[model samples]
Target: MTTLTTPTAARLAGITRTLSEWQTADWKGFLHPGDLGWNSMAGAEKSAADLRCWTADGTVVAIGMFDGEDLFRMAMDPAALDDDELARQIEADLTSGRVLPAGTVTVEARGALALRKRLRARGWNEGEPWTPLRLDLRTPVPAHPRDAALRVEEIGLDQADDWISVHWSAFKGTPPSSDDRRRLVHRWTTMATGPFAHLAHHLIGYDNTDQPVAVTTVWTAGDGRPGLIEPMGVHGAHHGNGYGTAITLAGARVLQQHSASAAVVVAENSTAGALATYLAAGFTASEPVTDLIGSVTQRHP
Candidate 1:
């Protein structure tokens, strides 16, 4: 029998453990352990509050997290990909207004074929697409002469401010306020100190002038499974200097050293430049995946 429940503090660790075990070399648009770490930017308590899990015989079979009030992202255990009953239960909860509110909502379940089929049969439309790119790390990464001018460092707590500065400047295009700095620091600290901290690497790239020009965080499920590079960015003022590719390669190298089978990243299909950067770093693109968009009111019985 299958059951659905939100994890408590004791179960949170188990949920993360199950998520880590779900990662595989074959690219799937599934929810990643890194996604949870990145979402911890809001705080672990809030992340737990928004997460739901489906279990069979005391083992997790599926996991979902609400991205804000409207987007519900999920991943199913690959072994249960064809479990129709589980898919139906997931769809029911999604449209029943108990998990998400009663209105239009987006579901990202690219790897969940059974769930996707159910949503399509119910008339859900496809949303925007995202491109997944991956680099096999069985071989050593090629070194670039140009990257010699950039220094990549694996950061610790003391360098949290520098990490926050580059992240805000790269993504927000503005200087971070005191409150913003505090929040970003807390986010980094929470992940750095969490149960899966050993699986994470926080990296920042510096130019010849010693200015922080790029930043990224990499997470690995374990050896033989693909690692993830989430939230990679170049400082807004330094966009044209090849920093994005350099920083990406830096992140990939960390994963390689850590014994990850490959490094994977996803970018919005509309962001041609971001896709280009990953390509330049030797990541091959895979088929793009789109979210399913639907209104709760239109759900079929």
Candidate 2:
């Protein structure tokens, strides 16, 4: 029997695993295991509650996770994408508030060009474009051209506050509270004991005075697979000091050490500075992906 249901926390592992298996280089920058890992490890309790799954005969064929109320990041097995019956069923559920409420919303689907075209015909418009870049790690990554003056360290429980502080400083926002950092530390620590522990790493880069000035989180899909540097940033005070490239290279090294064939990252097409940093770190750009935005409305059979 095929059914729709909200996944409980216990079922998160299965969902993330299925998503990882479906990921291919062709679907690079789409939803993947690392996205879920980052969510779970960073203690995205609220977003976790929003996860939805479509299962057929005890197997998950489709999954969706909300980045926020109006933006749903999702993917489906390629077979389901080609199955007319399942495609219609998914459309019905999404429009009837079974997946999300009625309103304007966006869905980023991997290899769903047909669905995107259909939605566009129904008054939906294309959302912003995102560029996915990758660095080949099949061979050893060359050392940075600049001297290695900065020091990078793997983040641990004791460095939770420092890590959070660096992130907030980079984004210029209200800092995460001590309680929030504690939750993140707990989640990361708990994940370390789990089956997927080998695929994740959190690193912080410190300046000469021993102040944390940059942070990054890297995730791999196991050896010889493509890895990701989902969130990498340098503190605002340290922006011009080459910390961005320094920390990004550090993240790539972590992934390479784990035997990843390549390191990948996605950023808004408009984020010129970020794109430049990755390019400087030895990454080459790949084809861009677009997000599809539409109002929740009935689609005729």
Q: Name the candidate that leads on TM-score.
A: 1
Residue lDDT tens for model 2, 260-281 = 8788888889888898889888
**lDDT tens digits by residue: candidate 1, 122-186:** 99999989988899999988675558978999999899899889989988999999998998888
What TM-score would each prediction reach against the true structure? 0.95, 0.86
TM-score result, candidate 1: 0.95
TM-score of 2: 0.86
Model 1 lDDT on a 0 to 1 scale = 0.86
Worst 10 residues of 2 by lDDT: 39-48
Instruction: Return the clash pairs for model 1, or none.
Output: none
Each prediction's number of clashing residue pairs = 0, 0
